[model samples]
Target chain A: MAIHHLESVFFREKVAEALEDQTLRGALQNATGLFRQRRLAATASLSDWEKLRDQARAIKAETLTHLDHYLPEFVAKAESNGIKVHWARDHQEACQVISQLVSEKQARRIVKSKSMTTEEIGLNHVLETDGAEPIETDLGEWIIQLAGETPSHIIVPAIHKTKAQIADLFVDQLSIEPTQDAEELTKAARRILRHHFAQADMGISGVNFAIAETGSILILENEGNARMSTSLPKVHLAVMGLEKILPRLADLEVFLRLLPRSGTGQHLTSYQSILSGPKRNPDQEGPEELHLLILDNGRSAILAEEITRQSLACIRCGACLNACPVYQQIGGHAYGSVYPGPIGAIITPQLAGLSETKNLPYASSLCGACRDVCPVKIDIPEILLHLRAKSVEAHENGKEAKGFRMWAWINRSRFRFVWAHRLARLGGRIFMKNGQPPQWLQRRAPVLGAWAKHRQVPTLAKRSFREIWKKELSRKQP
Target chain B: MTRNEEAKEAILQRVGQALNGGGVRAPRKHPITDQHYAGRPQTDLDLVSSFQEKLESVGGKVIRAQNLEQAFNELWSICQERGIRNLACSDAPSFRDLTDQAPEGLEILDFPHEQAELLEAEAGLSEAQLGIAETGTLVLDGEQENHRLTSLVPPVHIAFLSSKNIVLHLGEALSRAQQARSFPRTLTFITGPSRTADIELTLVVGVHGPRELVVFLLP
Candidate 1:
């Protein structure tokens, strides 16, 4: 994948690098702006949008609360529909199961849709290592694959690329004449990938909503690439997060309205496929075999936490990504994860654990724009704060802990408090150069200086308010 | 235990534990409410025009015919305009009248016997089970013989939809589907032709599936 996986601490460095690129900034602004406008317009048609959000939230919460029951029901229904179900506790296990299936089928060529689950497990890399070609058929995914990169946005994966850049990529990779027109470029990709779609022995897709009652998996896509990937191949495999299941088919009415409106502002995506199983007879010309892999991959850990489990309600609409002020500036690759933006900041830490992903929670401004747009009403900012507190608790013996200790000591009594104020005034006088703090303060005073990097330090008053109060009292008595 | 069985056990156990709050509470059930759409008809116009306007807005063509004769005429003219000679069609009775009157030199590859011909054919024709007015979507199930590939693989797809099958909203369609014995292995709610805005946000039609979708609404 072209998206580099760096430790979360490099978030700042990545943000800085992304901000420095003028072309990338323009592309991000244009793409996110269009998405934001369209989403606003799409939802503007409805009067009960908030009511719908609440209903969606309640439904997800209910389904997850009884997951132990609902999951088995889904499995049974899926099995009865001539579909095979596999369970994996982690990404490694998920990859292993898929690899076993590939080997069993002797599938040399595999075509795939834009599935974050596959990306989450690094499935393409695994397939390559296992000698099976995993070809991404989605246009955005295909471009990124050719460029050796991962998706930058959930809806528009290659949003960072301009038409000229895409043309250049096609010219280099597909040996086509360089053209900047988007339609011509798409035509070139279609001509090239059409053959691969027909030749692929197996197809892999990601599920948007798995209707447990009907034993059907819904895949939402504007491009028909996903439809092709599932239809042309002899065998079809769909991988889904365990939390993607819905309790009833009727719930799709709410989600089907919310998802497209929030994602790219389409009334409905060009194609919404509700595939229950593979081709059943000579009548249907779909895949002969169908397999669905329900992957847990640390989502159960999220479900285990009472406060943060609501994060699983996310429908991956990418609405929050467009609404996020921070995401609009830095784009998704800066987060260094398959999922990015507000949902990513909250869920990635829990899914991957806090040790390496602790810095992710700090990647937000807590503006609640994400919560406003989330179809399932995941309280993203609240979850971010929760994760931040958890991260701090794990770092109790660190610099912040010492700073809090000093703060406690100063507020113990009047004398110490006065002395602390005096010391602060003196430090400000010494540190202030040209009426501003020097750049070296960041290196010298680690905590305060780090805070000063993106903000202005509040100047200490010339005289303490306590001193002025005492003098005024003495004057009144006289 | 076998790995698959052990994995399932571990997952289900984790879920039970999570719902139980690590032994703090007991498993609880949450009530699910259905009939969410208020069960009111929102559209003022007749179902066919509403469905037609909605479908055409998304780049799909809706040919309105009062009877099967006019429907066949519209289809024949469409085939002439597209210059389609070999059209793959479904074996549904709704399209039987049109198939019988298929233009001269037009070879209809009727399924399930000719299902394999859809892949190589330029155009495919099938009868939709339902037409949704709210989104201009055609609902088709996989259980129907010659339904799947006839509408998917070909560059152009022509669907025959009856006026009676038109619904006011998706909720109506869902309720109908819910009452069914069981959903087929595959179903589709196609709104427009296969399109993508993936490349620099420019709309490109016909990425993988049929580039063109034409529907004939018969009264």
Candidate 2:
């Protein structure tokens, strides 16, 4: 299992690879574009969509503020409702607990419903190392698993793989005949997974929301596989983040209105399940033991930062991923972590350590599209700047961030301020002219150089923003 | 300390230092507001009709029945057509009445009642505490053993809803739940079944939930 303490250097290389690959560009652009369109259409029915976003943000903010209270209460309530809850501070321990259960159950085969949390924890690889044959039931996740690749998109894990590629992969992995048609492709994949579904001893999944008031785990999906994974299997293990908690059962109402509209642009998801606990006594079919692994994995660090804390408000609807310009071009693979897109750019750096994954913070156009489409209304561009500061702080112990502090000191003196402006403008022109543009635009990681790649300085017109504003003001004064 | 505990402790310490407190909470400046449902009604009937209208808009069938007996007749007919016999629910009086009205050997159980046990049932019959008309949501409370698991763990869930308990928006239903003064230890607002977009952005339903949800709307 790859204990991916991924470094910034790795992300830079991957981003470079993504830039060079037009095939990946087309796939990402195509998929994100469709998602954006669908999402827009879905939200159109709601007249007060913006207001709804604000409301959702307020609710999340309120929950987080009282999270110290809510978290303990949620834990207690879930336990009361017959949920076996375990707290994992990081991915490795989370995996250990799951594997221990698998060992305890003597499980040889496992099936999974689609969960980004499991992906973040690298659960599949861990299980495989433990000699458990884990099968990804979701079609996209299944493809990525079979291909030995990480998910490139939050919602569409196999967005990089075309239908023909999937057909071929299926033929290779399973002795199934291939067809190019999507329905046929889906049927083929489903046929392969159906047997695994009936045979798997344990199931793993991710929660959409852990309702604190009810201790009900909300999972929304379109396929019957999640049903089977948690239902047919003897034991079900769910991995969730602490941030996924909402205080009341009523909160699901707001999330339901927002999630599908922001994610797939559906007014309502096809299947919504409220899993209270393990299967009841004499129940027809459901998991015997239900265990929830609440993973922290560096989120508390993110929570401590005033700026980046808003990033935690994300619902993982992938709306921001589709809305991000940088993500649309390079795809999820370039990010080199479990999370991808604009959200990943900010989140991955924090989770893996900014010193190690600092390049991720730079992977944005700062177009503010992610913030625009975010259901929970996280101000991503602002968070991006905050993370950039955190990254610099991580590197210089305060020196890398000294540039801003230096500018602040310089700004107090008109002489130093003007001098600095002249120097910066002249430098911008020189770098813009002599550096071959691509050198600056080229990021080793999608999070870096991605902006400069598609944009250029218009040969700084011998003026800065202050100077331009001053001249405009003088003209108006006349 | 275990690896996870160490991580959590590290997070707590790091964040605590940053926030300048042993533990500090992040709070938003303003209250939340919902502006999605335009021209939604304040009247209960409006809420029920609006939600009913939406369910129908999504190619779903929504019919108003006069009583529990009428609802059961319709459900039984559907079950018979589908060859379903076993049923599970979260012990609602209406559902209990329907189960009592059922023929012998029609298996039924209120779900998630016994931890770590499987109820080898085919169909499920459950009653919703409250229904949201705008988004087509069914409210479930866990303090009642029957509410949470009945719809989720079953294959086919026939959600028995009374029209009188329907609300216009999620906010209304939620506010009402809180207004009930003493809150249930666990409240579940189930909008639909368990679903996922993890697979190639394809939406799949019945993932860790009931594949078929048939709402029994009664007067």
Superposed Cα deviation of residue A451, candidate 1 (Å): 3.1
lDDT tens digits, residue span A1-478, model 1: 1122535657888888999998999999999999999999988766777877777888888888778878888889988988988889888898899999999999999999999888888899999999999999899999999999878888889999988888998998889987888988988888778788878899999999988788889999987888888887889999999999888887887888889999989888988888888776655668889899988888887888768889998899999999999999999988888888888898778888788788899999899999888988888999999999999999999888888998998899989998989998998888887556887877887776778777778889888877787878667885
Candidate 2 off by > 4 Å: A1-8, A279-285, A392-478, B1-45, B63-130, B138-165, B172-216
Question: Per-residue lDDT of B79-155 in model 1, one digit per residue for the tens?
Answer: 88878887877777765645567888777776664434656788888888888988899998666645767787788
**Candidate 2 local lDDT, B24-143, one digit each (tens):** 454533253333333233454576678777765554456678886677777777777787777666665555544567766565554345532233466666677788787777776544
For residues A351-441, what per-residue lDDT tens digits would candidate 2 score against the true structure? 7766667788788879999888898888888878888876766667454456567768999998998897788777666656544344644
DockQ of each: 0.62, 0.24
